[model samples]
Target: MPTQVIQAQPSTNAFSGFIQFWKDVKAVAQPYWYPNDSGDRAFSDVIRSWGMLFLLVLLIIALVSANLFNSFITRYLLDIIIEEKNPSKFSDTLVLFGLALVLVTLLSGFSKLLRKKIALDWYQWLNNKILSKYLNSRAYYKINFQSNIDNPDQRLSQEIEPIASNALSLSANLLEKILEMAGFLIILWSISQSVALILVTYTVIGNLIAVFLTQELNKINREELEAKADYTYCLTHLRTHAESVAFFRGEKQESNIIDRRFSNLIKNAKRKIDWEKNNEIFNRGYQAVIQIFPYIVFGPLQIKGEIDFGEISQASICCYFFANALGDLINEFGNSGRFSSYVERLSEFSDALKSVTKQPENVSTIKTVEENHLAFESVTLQTPNYEQVIVENLSLSVQPGEGLLIVGPSGRGKSSLLRAIAGLWNAGTGRLVRPPLEEVLFLPQRPYIILGTLREQLLYPNTNRQITDAELKDFLQQVNLQNLLSRVDGFDTEVPWENILSVGEQQRLAFARLLVTRPSFTILDEATSALDLKNEGSLYQQLQETKTTFISVGHRESLFDYHQWVLELSQDSSWQLVTVQDYRNKNTSITKTTGNTQLKIDSFLKDKFQTKLENSIGEGLSHKEMNALTSYSLSTIRSKASKGESITTNDGFIYRYNKDPKVLKWVMD
Candidate 1:
């Protein structure tokens, strides 16, 4: 299989392209991301985990109470040491404080462990659902066709995990934060009345900055996905034509292409880095301000006997609660930005698929043909780019058990006509009355070679439409492709046949396939062009024996003999359909006797130009006249002239010529 080299086509316009891309993504994600069944499940899981969240709340209360109790115990111990206060009471208080701290730490660990388990389960469930949706309804092919969006391969591969993973983790973290806020807010508010207000204000300020920075990062992430897909597309395209690149020595140029795409990616990444850096700077300063401000407001009160040391500790615990709640807000904001973008991308993919699958108006799928012959009633086909009709109002018919050689100059719609009949091309007018579609087989110029062994190639299209291996091998031998059997590892060998065999070999294999399938009529569109003359002759001979009616499109003059009728498409876009008998006249230039004495020379010229001669002679001649003319033999004419006379001249002896040439030669002599 020789690869055809093609330079990169123009980049689809960025603005228009991205708009469509975004639209497709939006369509895909809309139903999934909307608070529907899956969203409900996600919501339920977050709710279900609230039992552990409540336990976490209790753990926070215990930890805060234990610290306050420990502070009191410390003061009692100081009194005992300095003022001879009761030692037994002090020792008992210290023991209680240590036990409470241990119990609270264990409870918090258990809460964290339970929340983690629930988060992961939800993530897996949601991701599988998204994957299933993406796979259904031929969405993949429709997406590929309808949009210029790059690398759906990445959308399926990379984007999905992050979408599900981050979503689940963020949701779980927010839930825990809400519970933490509940546990701490009351205690902190009771302990430090006005200081609690300052904690809330600072938390709001810090989180707002984090949220804004994260939103910017989310934008960068979306752009990164697009950039990565673009880079992947180039690499895949390069792989598809690796041989062409090697032949053209384009490694350096391709490297530059890859490098330029990556550089754009790097710039986006740098912007994300800068945003994160600024965000961290604000976060650290805000965190320092919150940590010290809580202590500073409570410290003076405790010193002035306005509040106990235990009360100051409780205020610090309350600050932790409010901070945790604000953290949830920041976490939700970050994930909301990213998840929204994912939703947008997936939605666009789904919408484009829906639009594409809406079959064109008036496009009929010919399910069953109820006739003996296929007829194209004044069919006209137009090229998409050219907007010019390749075939116009061309009515043609092929009856059962009869054949036609569709002859035309290159690019004159011979193959296009077949494609229209096959129902692959829709830009055509006129009803093609087809007998059951299964009855017609079209072997294109370059036949498709699926990845399989020789046996699989023959058995394709009949996938499990069981045919014996022996019979398939026999068909292969008939097409002179028996050599393939030895080359193959075995009948079931799984190799890429398109790469393994040459195009000519593949066409021959297509013939083998045809023999097994044995449709009522076959159309060969230059199917034999790559084969040498002998194989072409043999294959056509096989078709004749099989009595398989065929419509062949080719410029090879040799095919004219195999077909009984030729339909030559004219430059004026008219069709001249004629039988072989119409080309039988013997007086045309093609029929003029040559003076080449060599046997091979005469045989070769006659074989090569015989069809042209027949056609030239038949153009204006009646079928009966043309037949009567070929029926007049050179042997019979020579025999009759020998019987009459030979007149000798200085140059040579002459037999009967035309009446005019005879008299004039005699007068000159």
Candidate 2:
């Protein structure tokens, strides 16, 4: 027996498809036409205020009337030339024809000018409204950081103008087409109802086919946008990390990554082009058929003497324009596809902005209040994803005229705690009582070097101050950045400060800004890490001289001298707070007791091994130093010492050289 064959049937529900297509179009268009805010409704506002709607209606009426009059004159002239053959009437007909032509041309030019003006006005208004909303809600940060939305910058900068301009232009064109179709339908039906019926049927069928062909275009367009954004992001990443890539000599690796992104973009673009090409081919064939169909229907009438040459010409013109007007969907399928994609992007971005600005319901946020002291009450901190807890029910406080230094191992939420204090991260429940925002200043480790003049840098986050040149220079001198002005050609000169200034210099400049502002509370998250001991001590001394109370996050023991209290964060989401003096006293006792034991161990090692103990241990002495000496953790060191794989002195320090004589020989050699 032969194998049975089955072929899939195409969807025959053209009516339902047509309805869905219209519904999709309406969904894209409704937001701009009828906006949530009356002020932002560009179309309605512009039409009402600019009198453009009235002008448009009048222009359409005049244009249609003039075309009818022109048609009438052509028919009359033909009748006279063919039937009456009067030369005198021919001159009169020519003059009437010239005048009608002139009137129509003037009306058409004026209408186009008016339409352009209205479209431009609407574009400007809508662009401003959308831009304001985007910036006001700080959606740029949310979209860039939190949301998966792609190419917000492109949507705002590139897509908005075209969306606004095309929306108004398409609406006007559609309205004009409607009027033209209505006016010409009468002429075609009077000539022959068969021509009118043929035109309508042809338009309906062509539009249905176009809609079906372009049904998946919106999905393809969105993919194209994503591919473009991906390629753009790749380029931006390369630019941002250019220095690192250059140092690593990884140009080939970066090139491969960029090539992959470009390849993906090309694939999507080719797919879009293929679909567009197919749509265009169909539209071109449809247009060719429209051109010849009228002549085929009306030629018989002219030959039979039922109509004159003028009647045939008028009927063809009327039928063609009427059919063209009704076949808008077929002609504008490509544009509609792109327009729908643009609408979806813009609407999604707008909604994302709204979502970012609105506070999440039923989620507990850190409640901040103004007070003289900076305190965290019953604070519980977690990652933004809530995957791990950082600080659990911790309470700490730092009063005026005091500084609190927060110390923790890496990944113990030291920076996150600072972010919580700065109000940037609000992932867990807490009551953080602190001074008002204006009264507090935060300086992160990597100082944000904005693009501006040196003066602007000093006055950042408060640009409307009345500080004199002398005062600004004094503050710069205090932070030891007095030479910055001379290097950058004084305060008013602008340069790329991030590139021009070293990291340490930028950090000091940040301190200079803090000194200038002199807020009641200052939070520093390893802000002095880039500075040497001298500069760091000087900056902290200046802070002490000022009225600004500060909370610092650092690992250096020197930081304890400047801070009044110490808050040490542990790995188990617990923290211990102690007075800085008490912590220093405890450490001092331990150090004194450990110092004698270390001396005894050093003497014994030197006497027995004939090696300099200082050279073996190197410069620094701490848990880190011990790890470097033993290549193991404190727990590993303790375990190995118990098993004689390492040796521990009375100071609780491990030496790997005792168990492995080869290690000591290698070090001494």
Which candidate's TM-score is highest?
Answer: 2
lDDT of 2 by residue, 345-387 (tens): 6666666666665666666667877777788999998765466
Q: What TM-scores do the predictions have? A: 0.61, 0.73
Model 2 residue 267 distance off true place after TM-score fit, in angstroms: 6.2
> In candidate 2, which residue pairs clash?
none
In candidate 1, what are the lDDT values of residues 313-360, reduced to their tens digit? 556555755675677657776666556556555554444545544555
Which residues of candidate 2, in runs, are more than 4 Å off? 1-163, 212-227, 256-284, 330-366, 381-389, 425-430, 468-474, 477-502, 584-669
Error of 2 at 278 (Å): 6.0
- Go through the candidates in order and give each one's C-alpha lDDT: 0.63, 0.74
